[model samples]
Target: MGTIELLMQGFAVALSPESIMFALIGAILGTLIGALPGLGPANGVAILIPLAFSLGLSPTSSLILLTSVYAGAMYGGRISSILLNIPGDEPAMMTCLDGYPMALKGKAAEALATSAIASFIGSFIATIGLVILAPILAKFALKFGPAEYFALFALAFATLGGITGKNQFKTLIAAALGLMIATVGIDISSGVQRFTYNSLHLFEGIDFLIAIVGLFAISELFFFLEQHAGDGLKKVALNKLKLTAKDILFVMPASLRGALLGFVSGVLPGAGASLGSFVSYTLEKKVSDKGTFGKGDPRGVAAPEAGNNGAASGALVPMLTLGVPGSGTTAVLLAMLISLNVNPGPMLFQQSPDLVWGVIAALFVGNLVLLLLNIPMVGVFVKLLSIPPKYLMPIVTLIASVGIFSITGSAIDLYFMVGFGIMGYVLRKVEIPLVPVILGMLLGPEMEKNLRHALVLSDGDWTVLWSSGLSIGLWAVAAAGLILPMVFGSILRGKMKRSKDGLVD
Candidate 1:
């Protein structure tokens, strides 16, 4: 059968009453889980895996439900980022850079609405891409070896100076500190502990989720206590609650660009939504910023939202086509599929066309459901800003505390979280950007592992790093990333200033 006929049959299955019902339930549940700080999509899907089995859901029905949740969680992650400056997940961290700034500027409603639209656009496009390009992208992703992966990570780190557009020295310090922290665990290549301090808890190294919660959520709590400020907690303006046509038009190009970048990133195993978001925000800041990107520009909110959601959808490509999970959440989904005896690979399309295409169709449906569900709730989410700090701070603390403890069940991790929170507070006090620290922590280990693996494979020949055309291209991009920022940073700022002053068109 042709692709269109298979897709149409899959839609027939996905549109069944039972499938639609499961999709709705999954979408709502996933959104709630995602809105809670720290409990991201992976946990959400994992939590429901047992339930699917207990209920004896068919393979198609269970897959549809879980995949819907995955999509919904991606959409919901922006909520905490925009309202509270706490990312609901790692991928949402970039959203907090500008989304919270928009909230502080009393444009919280606009930011939320704009993000919802951009997310829809991104997921819609990525789902279409998945439908058309899954096999081809899977094959392309196989071309990335250890050297290419290392260079890709290098490109990510090289972009940080431009992403933050802050003090390069301070950013380097923060990133270095993160890399140092990542080295605390036992070395995979050597099995020797580096900085565990003879403690059992440190053996596994710091969990990035715990670090993220502490750094963003707990630190924000400290800031709240210090300021005790309720001045910015006014009710959202109803007049600005809805998105204008100009606002839609203004963010459309950035969203499109971000979605494309995010989809490509997601296609590559290990690149994931975090990189998609980081790259999208960095590129948008370069391409379209008028000095307002990190200061609450709607494009800033739109770009990352689109990027992350696009990556979320695109991550399924490798999972379904090659049986290689592209992101962490998809890893969990992979295990679930294995448990259900559904072997995903090139043969999955031919052997279980009904199950495979049903899930894809459900993803398309779930995107629509999320878009419809999120837009009407913007006013509700914006009301979070009106809550006084005295009452709200404790709730934030409680949520972060509970979420972390529930995930790790380790008191030491909680203490570590508090320590990281203090560290984050102190870093912010010195005018240091926190995103680079998180970025380093996220990518440092992978970068090191890939570099080591490449060296081992090449028998310590360093030239292997640049031998492949892909690796060489990535190296060139990394070099350009480091150099172009320094060259264009001042020029862009100058142009933005002139534009603001009516001296430039």
Candidate 2:
């Protein structure tokens, strides 16, 4: 079938009454949570995962809601940034520089309108990119052998340093710590308990969800408690709601460039939406003569919104093609797929055409929904800011705890969650990146499984690691992923020094 025909078939599935309902619910909830500070796509997914499970949501339905939530959250993040000067997450930080400035100038409605339109453009562009690129990538992925798979994992692991905080060494150490934690259960291949300490519960190994909840969800709660002392909350005005034609014209080029930049960045393993936004912002500044970029330049609002939305879609590329996530949020989605027994990778398109196509089709529909939802409901969403923190935080905390507790009904899980929350708080304070820990936990088991399988097949022949050209190429990529960052950084630094000297002269 032609691409258009196939997409139409997929849309038929997405637009069904049930799917549409769930999509709308997902979008609404996603926007609600994402607009709140400290609650981002990753955390929002984690918090709601248990609820999704409890509802016995179908895998497709569940994913539609979750992914819609992801898309919606990306749209809603700008709401917080533009109005309160507080980013809903790291990715939205750049949006705040221009978004808030627009709001301060009583252009809140225009700022939101531009952001919404930019989000639609980015999402639509990325969805089209996915439709065209995903199949090709998946076709090539079918050629990968076990060695190549092992090398791909290694490359993803090596790239962790680039995404983490200033202390790359510490990030590596934290990642190693997570891997070690993964070893606590009985080894599946050898049937030997590696680090269980003889506990029956440990025999099954630490649950990935539990660990993630502790590391991120719990950590965030503690951080919230600390920041609770601050008085930064501000009400957003909802009087104006239109973007001028000139405003649209001004931001069009930047949004397109940002979408492309964001997609490329998101396709790289470990570089999440935050990096995409940062790159797009820098690119726009370099290309445009706008002095108000960080001061509410409409392009500033458009660029990051476009970049983040495109990055969100682009991150799906690696997950669908390689079964590896390019970011923490994708890692969570990957876990969701596994839990549903839906194995991703090149074979996925063939194995689950309905799911894959449905997801792709839903992206297009979801973007349209967000565009409609964002513009008309601007007042309602803005009103959400009025719900006082005293009331809001408690409800959020209660909902999160209740949702998580519903998953396994294990009080112990709750304890682990709180522990991780405290750990997350400390990690945030120390500026140790939490994402690497989650990424490590998610990939550690897969990496080990692939490595052991390859080793067994090779019968102790270490040289078999490089037996395939694909494996060698992957190893090369892995090596470059590690080394190229330093080379690039040095080059950029030298150019900066030269520019400074020229300015002085």
Candidate 3:
């Protein structure tokens, strides 16, 4: 069928009564989960996996629901970040740089409104890109072999390192940690346990869902406890919550630029929403006339919000088209796809055109709904943040634990969950970036498998690592990721020092 015909089929599926109900439920629940400090789309989806299965939802229906949740959570994150200075997720951190300041200035409603509109714009733009470019990218990715896949993974790792900037080292460290976690199960190639330590449960390996929930949701509970409790929410006037036409017109250019930049960065490995927000903020700083960027420029709020949402949408491109996720959240999405017996890759388009197109189409609808939901209901979301931390954290923990237990029905998984939660909390206290550990865990097996296969095919020839031109190119890029960032940091420091000495020329 032609693309248009295929999309029509997808619309029929997405607009079905059951799918619509599921989408609405997901959007509402996702917004609630994401509005809670530290609970993000990844965790939200992980926690809901068992629930989806309990409902016996079709794979397509489940995906639509989850995707809606993803979209809503992305929107919901801004609410807490802007109002309470507590970022709902890592990507929302950038939003807090100026967002909280605006809230403190009694512009909480305005900031939320602006962020909502920008999010809508960014998501819609990226969804359009997904619709148009998905098939083409899928066709190209179909050409990949094992070697090419390895090279692509390497490129993703390197790109993530570069895109993460100052925290790149921590990102790598996190990725390495993840790889180590992934090594715990039995070695399929050898049919012997590797990190099982002779435990019966270890033979199956650490469950990614358990690990993700512990790392994000459970760890966040500890942080929530440590902070001075009580709700940090502030009441804002409803009349003041609406955005002026001038406000929209003022931020239009910045939001558009940020959306475009975010989409491109999101498509690259490791870039994700955080890098997208960072780049968009930098560009806004360079271009905007307002000197109050750090204080509370509307543009500041608009840029990162737009960029991150765009990046979130953009991150899906590689996940669907290449079967390689660029971030932790996308990794979870990938695992979900695998569990659903849906293989995401080039052939996905041909094999499940309706599924793919339905998702893409739903994104368009979800963003529209989010914009409408957020603008009038900004007050409601802000009120959600008003729940006392003590009450909220316990409930969140209960949801997380119940969701996890339901998945495997294993007490052992619960133990792992708690243990990893402690580990995640400890790691966060040391100022490490959590993203890298996830990257390592998710990609480690693939990397090892490809490396082994390449060597075996080359008869244990060590030089085989550099045999393919693509392989060589990827390694070179990885080398650059290590070297160039340092050089750039030094150059930036020198320029700053020179400027301070009044030697600008």
Candidate 4:
């Protein structure tokens, strides 16, 4: 059957009463989980995997719920970012950079509304790309080998440079720390401990959830306490939530640009929403008017929101089409698929049309559902800003701690989380960016695995990494990503350098 016919059939399946109900529930739950500081889509989905099975859901139904949560979490993450200056996930990190500034200027409602609209646009673009490009991209991805995968990972790291903070050196240092942390577990190839320190818990290395809670969520509370002296950010005149026609028109192009760019980045493995949003934000900043980016612009909120949702949707392609997980969230999703006896690969479209198409259709429907659900609730989310610090901070901390403990079920994780939170707090004080550290921790091991795989395939010959045209092209792209940022931002370098030295504005 043609793609249209298959999609129509999928929509029929997804639009059923049961599917629609589950989609709504997933959307609500996803947003709630995503909005909660430190607990992101990955944690939300991971927590639900057991519940999905216990509920006796079919594979299609479970995936509908999970993906809805996935999409919803992307939408929900911006809430804490805009209101509280705390990012719920990696992609939301970019949102906080500008969104929080807008909130400080009493435009929290405007920022939230813009983020919702942009998210819709981004998800729409991703759905279109998935419907039209999945097969083609899957076909193209079949050409990838270990060398290409390694190069792709390199490109992911390269693209992340110099965007996190004023000091590239501090950023690299943070990333190296993550890399070292990622190496603490057993070596899969040699079956030898690397840095376990004879502790059984160290055998599994650090749990990603523990780190997220520590670095982003818990650390944030520490900073908030110190900065505010246990007070919330002062909010102002936050009861409005309507977007003007001109505002809509103003952001449409930026949203579209971000969605397209995010989709392209998402198609590649390992380059997920965080990278997509960061790149889109940087590119938009370069093109936008001066003094409007970091100072609080609606377009700033719109661009990253669109890019993040687009990248989140686009990352699913490789998971469903090639059975290769892109981001950590998708990896968790992939695990659930396997556990449910659903194999996702080249044959997924053919063998499981209902499952595949149903999920895709649900994504389309869920985007609309999230839009409707969220747009009306913008004020509700914005009101969260009004909660006083003494009450709200403890609630946030409680939520974060509970979420981490539930995920890990270890007191040790709590200890480590606190340690990392202290470290993160200190790093922020030193103006170090946490983005590089988080990305490095997540992506470094995968890159190392791919690099090792390529070396093994070529009998330990390093040249095998650059043996293919695809690999060469990817290397070129990686090189360009590293060089272009430095090249284009030379004007900002002196200012940033001075900022690091406390010598200039």
Top candidate (lDDT): 2
**Per-model TM-score on C-alpha atoms:** 0.61, 0.92, 0.88, 0.69
Q: What is the lDDT, from 0 to 100, of the residue 206 in candidate 3?
A: 82
- As for candidate 4, its clashing pairs are none
Runs off by more than 4 Å, candidate 1: 1-119, 130-135, 162-169, 236-363, 493-505
Which regions of candidate 4 deviate over 4 angstroms? 1-118, 162-168, 229-359, 489-505
lDDT of each: 0.78, 0.79, 0.78, 0.77
Angstrom error of the Cα, residue 452, model 2: value is 1.4
Higher-scoring candidate on TM-score, 1 or 2: 2
Candidate 1 lDDT over residue span 1-505, tens digit each: 7778978998999899999999999987788667755557875675566567657789999899989889888888888778777688878888887888788878877888899899989899998899998656445656788898788777766656654555667877887887888898899888999999998888888876667667666777788778864543445453367678999999999999999999987876556787788779889999998888778899988998999899999889977876656676775676567657787666788789999888888888888888888888656644644666778667657766776676567788889888888987898889786666766676677679889999999999999999999899988977886777678767755643442343111
State which candidate has the highest TM-score: 2
For model 2 the TM-score comes to: 0.92
Looking at candidate 2, the ten consecutive residues that score lowest on lDDT are 496-505
TM-score, candidate number 4: 0.69
Q: Enumerate residue pairs that collide in model 3.
A: 174-436, 174-437, 175-436, 175-437, 175-440, 178-440, 178-441, 179-440, 179-441
lDDT of 3 by residue, 1-505 (tens): 6778878888788777777777778888888878877778877876677577656677788888888888889889988777767778867777887787787778888888889989888888888777777788988777665666777777767666544444556666777788888899889899888878899998878877678778777888898889837665655454476578999999999899989998987887656787687678778888994668767788988998889899989989988998778665777777677767887889999998878988877777778777878888777776777678888778878887887787788888999999988998998888676656666676678778988887788888878777778667767876776666566755643543342242111
Q: After superposition, how far is residue 50 of candidate 1 from its true place, in Å?
A: 18
CA lDDT for candidate 2:
0.79
